[model samples]
Target: MTIAETAAGVEQRRRLVTAIPGPASQALMDRKAAAVAGGVGTTLPVFAVRAGGGIVVDADGNHLIDLGSGIAVTTVGNSAPRVVAAVQAQVADFTHTCFMITPYESYVAVAEALNRLTPGDHAKRTALFNSGAEAVENAVKIARSFTGRPAVVVFDHAYHGRTNLTMAMTAKNMPYKNGFGPFAPEVYRAPLSYPFRDGGLDGAEAARRAIELISVQVGATNLAAMVIEPIQGEGGFVEPAPGFLSTLAAWCRESGVVFVADEVQTGFARTGDLFACEHEGVVPDLIATAKGIAGGLPLSAVTGRAEIMDAPHVGGLGGTYGGNPLACVAALAAIETIEADGLVERARQIEQRMKSRLEDLARSDPRIGDVRGRGAMLAVELVVPGTTQPDAVLTRAVAAAAHRAGVIVLTCGTDGNVLRFLPPLSISDELIDDALDVLAETFRTTTVTS
Candidate 1:
């Protein structure tokens, strides 16, 4: 449903609802069914008319707390004034010149911002793209060009993208990669240190095992790059143990393999740091960033050591809308807003609140096998009592309960037993408390056996 343009002086917290789907949203959905493709599936029933900092207004006129953060986009909040103004200004001037042909200031400005924001003190260069998948693919290409090798190493439960190369990089088989091969060649998978699942091995040990495999089977010298997610997003919000990242970084240094961190979901302060690599003090040879870079615009970037980035000859990298002025403007506004508004600190605040509340629930409930995450990107892993077997049934029930109670939550995990929380950093303390209360009530009241 199209928004009516909120009434003047209307408060942002109003939740007065005439109907959940309301008249307008249902009408729009019906039209959407015909106009839009059938590949997309929505998590919430109510259609959104408008969204701002931490709340979404449904076409039914109900106000709901935003917890999923648009699948980890809009981390700085939706419709940020700075982002809106920048986009408007750019649209008026010029939208596209194609950076490959005639470069624009906005593109270079964004690349500069990314260089400064990403980890590592070394000389860095950035190439902008339109999506995270594109960034991942380019990262592999750059790694190959730099190392003059063909083998790229990724981890199990990893999700790089939906493209051919990324499909090979991803671990899941049923939907993402299932019927989508013959995939790109020379991609190898390693085991990730999932402490909860991996038998009794510590973080460093997990990294060691993976290193040994590569050394024995593939031989690290032949590998071009090793790509990983600092905090795996689509594979489940899995935070690798303390020494895991550092160990991998050390291995890459010794082997001359480019260490690529796919920070597409964990970057831009979504995980409290400017980048998730900062959590372990591990600096990668390359980094791919997106999701929240432009507040909500389509922008992704590959930033890394200058020599490696430039290995691809001039004009080897770019797209028609690769770094469009409008998206670049949005990115500039987003970065400024993040710095000026202290969203990084805000992310820590959300993390503390989530940890305290969820840990308390874990202590009392056997179904809540684990509460894991860093910063505002957190999750609860559901499992059957006294066993590691995933409790997908309970996870689905609890999600449905939360929706009924007016809070939107999302489920993830290889087994679909993990409930991830990707709340906006700008969301209020009151909203956080309210959503946790709903979660607690859902857990307490829902019957697993039923």
Candidate 2:
């Protein structure tokens, strides 16, 4: 057997034996269309059979480079050895005892790990959940209970989730909140510090603008929480100007509003720091995390100050599968992999390499308007060649071209004009180079028609 077939690894290179979707994947897509909900969309129609390291093997044996990391879920790489081993052992013993019913050790262990890892050294407690949306929902509930207030504030371009209350908090409209509204009440939207678009306002000044709006409309006396993604994820990896987060967080602390950091995408080792809030030395009163938490398993958490987290009544929190044993064990293993492998620094290395390449692309390509993000989570905003107008059509065309060429890239932003890259830290440098080469070529080929 070759090195790829043996214990060391799966094939690390991208190889396209057939077209992008091929026959096998197309067949699955056909079946899915007939059975699955039409409301659920697919980014790349190709179905993955096996995935590891930086490669995702589709049904037709095409090994594609993974730049999205399952939308920032598989941070330790797919089928990470430790996660697999732990899941296997846990499954043999038990899958779900329902932590609310007959609590399990893995569940407690996972909670302890979250409380220790999340930003802030304050006395903290954690409540587990199954997805990022659940964590955010619970965080809001906890904040409301603690403050005995009814109003909440969120920033522009923020994406919390799809549930009733979160949809009201999310800023985007079309795909995430078009027809699904008639959303929850008392959620207010504030301005965000978009440095690229904010002219040259410094962080503190920009934050002042948002604070003024919030105080005027949703006064601190009535506000329960202020929820925001440290680096806005699905809305575009919009890293706020320097000091923006710190200024806002301080205001919340003094005003008694629970500052909630939705690090669902920027948590773990994806953004250089274990938590993106650490980048600004901002300590949130509550943090909702999910993506990249369990090496692909579905596990999320709300970690926060003990008094705030414990404000809800005895039975006010928890779900039937909130802290499922299998997910908890997978989380423990994933956390160990992150610390032992030094993935935090690895993310910084990836940021340096990717930012260099993307910046070089921007220098030569006029359509590339901005290069932003940190660590493995970087993005480029595409604009009309001469102006700041969003070139969403060109963005979509280029992404399709990359998908065809065996590189998986995801697009985001309210205008759908930003291309974000979230590569697994386990990915090799060579693999990243190859993916960038494909991206460069895709831009070149698509720019001709644009």
Candidate 2, residues 1-450, lDDT tens digits: the string is: 122431115688889999988999999999999999999899998999889888888999999989999999999999999999999999999887788888878888988898898888889999999999999999999999999999999999999998999999999998888988799999999999999889999889999999999999889999999999999998889999998999999999889999999999999999999999999889999999998999998989999999999999999999998988889999999999999999999999999988999999999999999999999999999998878788899999999999999999999999899999999988888889989999999988896323
**Which pairs of residues clash in candidate 1, taking residues 3 or more apart in a chain or in different chains?**
none
Query: Where does model 1 exceed 4 Å of error?
Result: 1-23
Model 1 residue 252 lDDT score? 96
Best by TM-score: 2
In order, what is each prediction's RMSD in angstroms? 3.1, 1.7
Off by over 4 Å in 2: 1-9, 448-450
Residue-by-residue lDDT tens digits, candidate 1, 129-204: 9999999999999999999999999997898999999999998786688787899999999989897888778889
List the pairs of residues colliding in candidate 2. Answer: none
